[model samples]
Structures are given as C-alpha cells and as structure tokens.
Target: MLYHIRCKKGDKTVRTIKEVVGHHFVQGQPGLLMAHCQNDERVFINFDHFDFLDFSNGWAKGEAIVAQKAAEAKKNEPPQPPPEPVINGPGGAS
Candidate 1:
C-alpha cells in the first residue's frame, strides 16, 4: 500500500511512500520507515511532524494526489506562445 506524508511545517513538504519496509512507535505514536523504490535512500517519518496521512484507498488515492499536483502545477505555469508559421520555398512545394 502507498502512504502520503505531509509535514506540519510552514513549507508543508510532502513525501510519498510507494511501499513501507518497516515502522516503529515513537512515544507511543507510530512512525513509518520508508525505502525508496528506485534507489538506496531511506526516510523515517515521525507521527508528530505529520500533518496528514492518507491510507484509505492506498494506490488510488496516491494516483489522485499525483494528478492533482500535476494539474495545479500546470495551472500555475504561464501560457506558451504558439510556434511561428513555416514558409516553404516555391519550386512546387519544397
């Protein structure tokens, strides 16, 4: 199952766990230990700094979150200008 972790800080940094390798309790609260699916990186997230954790739909929710982020990023980007028209040489169409 996938897990989404949101930071309680003002920047609100978000991290996604494709798969949780292990977990432990911190002061009776749960903490998740995640390993990267692509690399050797590992992350440990404490329950205290978590603003939100979504595990309801797992994969589906993660996909929705990714799509939502992509849409938001696209919305914030400036409109791109169209390409200039190309002129072909005569010669009956080069």
Candidate 2:
C-alpha cells in the first residue's frame, strides 16, 4: 500500500529532508521503518541485526550472501548436457 501525507506542509516538490532528530548505530542498514503520529516516535530495524549466527544456522554471513548470488547465476545458465529427447509411442499412451 502507498500513502500521501495530507497534513504535511510545503508543495509536492519537496525532495530532501535535512533534519535529524536523533541517531543510533546499527550493524546493518534497516529493512523496515515505522512511525507513530500520536507518540512522536519512529522505529527502524533490520531483523537480522539481532544475531548473525541466527540468521543462517550453519553458514557465515559472507558465504550466505555469496551462495545466494551463485544460486541466481546458476538459474541464468543453460543446462549442462542439454535436455533428453521425448519419444511418443504410436500405439496409444506410453
């Protein structure tokens, strides 16, 4: 879903936000962000930040990312031996 903030000031041309209310160090970039209008609060997080080990039980972080890239690359390559020929029987069903 998408939303337009109806109450915010300025025209639709506003493209940059320079203000920083606060800051906190995060191990990795955030994957999610949420705001609370009434409470004047916000949350940003990367769920994987909690524990690197927990993210991938037996694999290292770098290996996990690399493995995913290898898997994607494998998808683009053609089959090694080529596909086997399909033969149709003349009688009825084979």
Candidate 3:
C-alpha cells in the first residue's frame, strides 16, 4: 500500500518509506496508503517541526513492513520460461 500526503504545495502525491520525519518517518499523508501504482518515489514529506500523528502502529511504519514483504515476495517469484517455437517439418513429433 502506497501512502499519500498533501504536499506543502497542496498537491497530493504518493510517498515512499525512506522519508524521515522524527524518531519515526512517514511515507504518505494517511489516506493514500493502499493504492496500487507504479512508484513515483517522491511523495515523502518531512514534518520535523510538526506534531506526530500517533496512529496505532503508525500507518507509515505499517506500510514499510508490508512493502518489504511485497518486495520479498516479488524476489521469490518463479522465473517464467520462454515459449517454444512451432516446428512444422517431417518427423516432427506432435
């Protein structure tokens, strides 16, 4: 789940887990953490002087965990073999 944050510029964007905030960090704002999209990798915000949004388990943190698992799963995915070509000739076994 990718997180979302309303940028200081008032534009909403997807966030990444590498964004550092304080003792913790936030990926996106809050309401955009579960969307499937190609990573933009630039929605992270640093609210250093702002109050923390102490949600249970911290949505950003949770997203990090989930994202890690997802990456691992992708890495473990089985490699697909290439398709065979058609061979139409004498003695060709069907």
Query: What lDDT score belongs to each candidate, Candidate 1 first?
Result: 0.46, 0.35, 0.39
Q: Which residue pairs collide, candidate 3?
A: 2-33, 4-29
Runs with alpha carbons beyond 4 Å of true place in candidate 1: 1-59, 90-94
In the range 1-94, model 3's lDDT, one tens digit per residue, is 3333332222333332333232222333332233222443333334432233222224543454465456666767899899887777886746
Model 1 vs. true fold: TM: 0.32
User: Please, what are the lDDT tens digits per residue for candidate 1 over residues 5-90?
Assistant: 33334446565554443332223222432334333446655434555544434433334345445656776799999997676876
lDDT of 2 by residue, 36-80 (tens): 223345444332442221221233334444654565677678889
Give the best candidate by TM-score.
Answer: 1
Query: Least accurate stretch of 10 residues (summed lDDT) in model 1?
Result: 21-30
lDDT at 46, model 3: 40
Off by over 4 Å in 3: 1-59, 84-94
Q: Candidates sorted by TM-score, descending order?
A: 1, 3, 2
Q: List the residue pairs that clash in candidate 1.
A: none
Index of the highest-lDDT prediction: 1
Q: Please list the Cα RMSD from the true structure of every candidate, rounded to 1 decimal place.
A: 13.7, 15.5, 12.2
